[model samples]
Target chain A: MYWITVLVVAIMILSALAVLLLPNLLAAVAASSVVSLALSVVFVIIRAPDVAMTEAAVGAGLSGVILVLALRRLGLWGLGDDNHPRPGDSLQGSGDDA
Target chain B: MRNFTSLLFAGGLGFFLLVLAADLPVGAAPMVAGEGILGQGPEAVGAANLVTAVVLAYRGIDTLGELSILFAAAAGVGLILSGMRRRADQRPDPEGGFILLAAADLLFPLLVIVGLYIVLHGHLTPGGGFQGGVILAAAFFLPLLGRPGDSLNHAVVNWVEGLAGGAFVLIGLWALAVKGDFLAPMLGKGALGSLFSAGTLPLLYIAVGLKVGAEIAGLMSTLQETEAAEP
Candidate 1:
């Protein structure tokens, strides 16, 4: 039980750091979901199953879907793709035709 | 410099939280003289789940406020997305695969049943309206995954939201009329572990579940519509 708790806490910390450091917005969102999932596990360990269910459902599931939808709306298909130019970046002269 | 400032702020907050945490009991403390909420809550509220007793019976006003907050957020999202026009080029696939559509159809009703079960059993078990409502929303959301352009009936959503909201208030008013306290359990709490136990709590949770489900489904529809709209 102690080891499980320690493992979850470690994962939570690692995911939190990943969310902060990951450059790709989608990857950051994924990391954030992992953080939420790990936190839910912690909640379960502490006997707060209700809170755990909510965190898992809302934090990992709905929020992740919303974030991905927002990313799609921003025309960000994937990592390092220049099809949709981000704001404030230098224009590469009609790359839309490329 | 910005990083240093942020680090300093975070460190200060962490220290403050640690100090607060240090004051709390590490594990289950020996029962004290005074009867705590956990000790007396079930008998008082007739809810097997102490958490439900506290949330719906003891702190109902807080739950109402939370509902209002969620309503406001959903309303804001709807307002923001109202002006967007659907793009002709971005229409969802008209002929979604048979398997995808079939799966969505198969899963929808099952999910709804599970969601209702959770909400209805809130007083007796660990599940509640909030979690069940999200599940309900997810159930509604599944079909949209198969057919992205298809939207839930806004009029139906609005009606459900309005009626559920009104029902919650009316239930509280009824409690006030009967018990002279808002949100007081009206009907007699049945057998401790029975389906119909917890008097008005299960009813309130049902109302909450419907309201939250409708609200969240509406929010998702609005967001999906915006996604389908022209940039």
Candidate 2:
């Protein structure tokens, strides 16, 4: 149990760092979901199942989808460089400067 | 140098917290209120899940406040993005492809069933209204995501949220009229862990579930609609 806790916490921290450090916004969003997933596991380990369920549903699930939708709307949903957006690839016709 | 200083400060704060933690009890969580609640909560609220008892009975008003906040947030989103949606003629995003469509169709019913089960059995389980409500919202949103052209009826969404919020308040008022305290557990708390148990707690959770589900669905649809209207 203690080892499981340690492993989950390690994964949570690593994924949290990946969320910050990853250059791609989409990858970062996925990393954030991993962080939330590991966090839910941590919550379960600590016996706060209510909190774990909320974190899994909202943090890992809805929040990721919302962020992805927003990213797509902003036309930032791409597999390219973080700094420069490709021309004509943006569905909304421009970069998200707003 | 500035970054180094900031990192040093963060490390110092962390060390200070760890040092403070080292002095505290390891296994024993000095649960003063928790001990009281564990001893007397079942008798007072009669829910099998003590967390539900605490959430719906003891901190009922706090839950009401949370509901109000969610309602306000949904309304605020509507107000802010009210005019920012695409016209009917303008094309929304295409269908999310075959895989998304098939998966959405498959998951909708299952998600709905699971969500309802979680919300209804809140008194007996680890999940409750808020968690279940989000899953319900996701279930509703997935269809829209698969086929963005078929828009959600905003009018219906508005009514559901409004009625759900009103029902929550009305239930609280009923409790007040009967017991002189708002949201106090009445309705006889039938049997522990049973479907009809926990007095007004389950009713409150149902109201909470519907309200949250509606609010989140509206929020997501509004966001999805704002895709083509970006200025």
Q: Which candidate comes out best when scored by DockQ? A: 2
lDDT of each residue in B1-231, candidate 2, tens digit only: 998999899899999999999999999868988899999998899899899898888889998888888889888988988888777877677556567889999999999999999999999988989998999999999999988888789899889888988988899999999999999999897887788998888888988998999999999999989844243
TM-scores, in order shown?
0.87, 0.90
* CA shift of A70, model 2, Å: 1.2
Error of 2 at A37 (Å): 0.4
Which has the greatest lDDT? Answer: 2
- Going through the candidates in order, the fraction of native interface contacts each one reproduces equals 0.36, 0.62
Q: Write the per-residue lDDT of candidate 1 for residues B19-133, one digit (tens) a residue.
A: 9999888886566633577778777789998889888888898999999999999998888877873566765424345677899999999999999999999888888999999
Error of 2 at B86 (Å): 2.3
Q: What is the TM-score of chain B in candidate 1?
A: 0.88
Clashes in model 2: which pairs? none
**Model 2, position B193: C-alpha lDDT score:** 72
